[model samples]
Target: MPSNTDISKLKELYESLDRLKESGEDVVAEIRKEINNIELQYLKENLFPEMMKTLSRKISWLRCSVDMNLQFNGEKQLDYSFCKSGSTVFIRDKYECNCPNEDILEESEMDSNNLEIITSTSNQTDAHDTPKRSKTYTLRVEFPNGKVFQGNVVSDTYVAVIKEINPEKVDSVGLSHAGVAVVSQTLDSKYAKYQKPIGGGWYVMTNSSTKAKGFDLKTISDELELELKISLVPLNNSEEAIPIMGISESERHRIRVTFLDGRTICPMKVLEALVEVVKYAGVDRVRELGINCCADNLILKNPAPRYKKLCKPVGNGWLCNTCSDTITKFNQITEISQKLNLGIKVELV
Candidate 1:
């Protein structure tokens, strides 16, 4: 409210919405949308654009670790095979890194043989304050075709300056890395094994180009066979997340999570929250979970009797089966009235 709106009015609005929600009124979304509109108006409606700008900045550059292999000062040309190798297998690419490297390193086609690794004092800094010429980093990335690619997030400059580029790789997902069970490799490993997971796993990247190759929405969709589109949903911008916790149900891909507090959330946001929860407890904890939610009450009643279906009455009630059954219970009721105790009939007509 920016300390501008009247406090009493704001409190009244909040309480009214809470009451409506508690009473099982299905107007929460509409009410929340209105509230967002009000806040957006208060912000001069720049919230959407500003949020986009912030998200763009965060995705612009990502940082991570990488592996590097470089042989200094060798043959004029470089030749190498980029393929999966070792207990820790990494994907390969035809053309390697696009990051800037030393200027002396010459560029050539991927098939060129008799290559040399170029090193320059300016390209690297040594322990003794001396410049040495070796720089390399293995970046993590996934191709559009769902193949993971990991190599030096090096620049053209670095590749051109280095030589003796014959390279081979080993597979990490298979026994090449370790003949360990899935449980041991996943849960017992030093770190989460990105390889051999259903969904793509996390990867390391040292430079911008490498970071670009890491798991992204496209990579996920390709690996998981699910379509994904980055979207900006208009969530409540209030500093407080609406406190809600509930059982979630998914029937025909329509999921609903109803909190004990009676707040119902759509599956999308519920799934988002679940991601955070899973991260906190680890995947194993989440796999062992089941959710419960409140069910709606149902009341059953017999069909009403028609006048044409009624038979002649035996006493004070009609003889139709439905009508007679209803009258019999009351007619046979014990008399709490003093008149009935005196043998005066208290009739229910």
Candidate 2:
């Protein structure tokens, strides 16, 4: 059987077929064919490979058992060897023969080499054992409009989770990167030891000796005894980020944001959250909220160096000092939400 992750993907794919049908697209047959291809891919890449590994281990164990039984029963010494052909393992015996059959001798030599390779693989498997099964975790996605979507997802890579949650936007490079970064940051904060900081500011999470790009969401969920809730916020286009305490310095650690319509942008720093709000609320509306437009410190056309570090470009060659503590950012978001009549929420996690 395919893993839960693969099953979820298939389910989503099937659901999309229904959506396509409703949209009057005649590609239902094409999509069904694509689904079949995906299923075959999953079988070959995941299920079949896993089954082969298990079968190989069992065969090795049984062969050893048979050899021990033969020796204990006082049977004559017999050569036991196996060769892999395609997906099958063939066991054969090599006996001493004075016959001049060159073909037989060559086949025996090939089988012997295969046996050695299998033995080495079996030894390595014994040392490492099988990989741990991925655990299923409850996933909750909170949209900016207070809408919530809930589902069960397997503990896998951040990219995989996003694909399951928002399959439609998986192809969007900006949203995919933003979603992965948000999920990675949350996992890093909770399970720092399991996360490896790789190039491009991405974090790979794993519990095994081998490095993996997927974090164990099930472990975190189990520890907290709660479903993993991901809040989608909004961000401006020109927003940038600055590292703060207890957060990763990587650019990928930027807080993920999306438009109210669910279009996501690149994640930005807390300092840029205010810029996003100001852009959304319009400069005139922001000034109406008791903010001085001519001030050289905070929201102004030209700011001093001290305040400039905390500022970001907000169109029309204007700069706004949005860089501040998390609490301040939250308060600003709240204020903008109230004054502009927008339901905006910016959370650090």
Candidate 3:
């Protein structure tokens, strides 16, 4: 039989083990908290915008969940019906697909906790803390380069939505061109659809909504006579800066383009050219082009082939040849006919 001292020592050892286990658990909980912080920062920095999630409000770590869904052959279906269904559902973790179709799709986790994932949603809630309710829409476009960009659509107004659509089957788009339209549908299905010039820019809206059904302006015209309000939404990265392609913003607002010399312009052509330059040479090159502001000024001043400037004096101002001609047109300065004779009398007063 063990002595009293041995029993006491055994009890002390058990207490020590208990303390160690508690300490180990505390350390694990602390590490988990740090990991959550890192994950939240990464989502805020990269995932939210890329995924097209409305981030008007702040998300709570305890209350937030990472809702996700699976799409097979372009149709969304439920993987686990137990998961919540709502646009504003807080997904505790990312989605996982362990079904036989795993080879068709990929699976990933949002957190170490492995929380349940949402498959689909019919409604949206304020993910952010903002009081205003926002709806989520999708904007799909097939680019001229055979590339397709589909994501969340932002912008409450139709004009803003059109601007958000990316370029399609073309290099550039411009609003300043003779035939440019930022309308809701196709152009010619009606009475030879014409472009109407509006104050900020030109729009191709119809009196009836029937013409706005199909994506094509002309085809939509054949169906509906909807009232459309097209306008020049600022473009930074497409051809002629016109609506050759569509662009969309989160809200219907204007984009301001600024030059290096603090000069701002909203011309559709210039915006298109700027976008083309960026596409070919890259965005960094665009910044370098802005740095070369003098070159742009030269292009503006010389709008003709072999355009040249002649120096001339006007009323207290030095005008170029073009300005000089306009000022002296009425007061014709024919020639200087001051003839001085060799023996001319010198009149001294």
Candidate 4:
């Protein structure tokens, strides 16, 4: 049942066991320790979803058709081996299960408090194991329909599949960005029938195949290639920002707050409302504003009447389109956050 990555580690562990035995070490005890070490590592990170699936065992069951392969070199990829098998997979299912398993592990309050909300992936690769540079990069993709997607990339080779959203597929996803082309429609597509905003949708990008860091995605297709040229935009609300077409005001700039105490607030507030959050809810108690939980407030940065640096008929008494005067606004926010000792982040969805 081991994956390729797991088999590799198991082989290394066997070699270590042999070496330890030859050195007059207690082979049985030493191997036990070695196996325990491996278990500890897997406990730290489950590259496979086995544990997660098991936790949801009573919810629903599915299976994965896995293909295993090994190759020594590219030139002689002919020198390869492979195996295929069917595996029963238990994953989270949409059908609400009122039956709760006492043994089911839920994220603890402590864990929720420490949970990171905003995580960025990168797409750069280094072949020679060069020293890693602490480089942070932002990714922005603006659709011709005035829809903008923004995020940070922390990995050099993190690739996202750019799929043109289809209306027929719209009734099949909860995230609004799912039901992609490269992937098969999920079982929950039926659940999407109840979703609102029926019609043509924006082109969306979701995680795709990854081979190496710094891989050229253009090789995939013309559509995939164009995704790499996404323009960068300021994350904070800008004075002259263009409203992303199709997305609602509540959907675009709204803030969703989640606290460490297992509480959540989906108040449709906005840009300056972050200050009040810190004032009311102290700094450390606020777990997150954007990631995981619903956003805390709505900046209403999009759905502009017309795209402009200082667009007309601006709401909130200001243009939400320009990149101008960001420093001052950020300063004001920073001052408020610092004064209240809050570690709040203002994110635009």
Candidate maximizing TM-score? 2
TM-scores for all predictions? 0.16, 0.26, 0.18, 0.19
**Model 2, TM vs. native:** 0.26
Each candidate: what lDDT?
0.28, 0.45, 0.29, 0.34
Residue-wise C-alpha lDDT for candidate 1, range 42-129, written one tens digit per residue: 3443334555689568755644222222221223432222111121232222334444433212221111222122224335666788
TM-score of 1: 0.16
What digit string (tens of lDDT, one per residue) describes model 2 on residues 239-325?
A: 232111111233122333455777554344455566777788776566557643224334566554323333567766767765343
| Per-model root-mean-square deviation over C-alphas | 32.2, 26.6, 28.1, 23.4
Ranking by TM-score: 2, 4, 3, 1
Worst 10 residues of 1 by lDDT: 291-300
lDDT of 4 by residue, 181-287 (tens): 22223323433332222223422223332221112122222222233334323344342333222322322333344434545444432323443444455333332
C-alpha lDDT of residue 269 in model 4: 29
Ranked candidates (lDDT, high to low)? 2, 4, 3, 1
lDDT value, residue 312 of candidate 4: 20
Q: What 10-residue stretch in candidate 4 is worst by lDDT?
A: 290-299
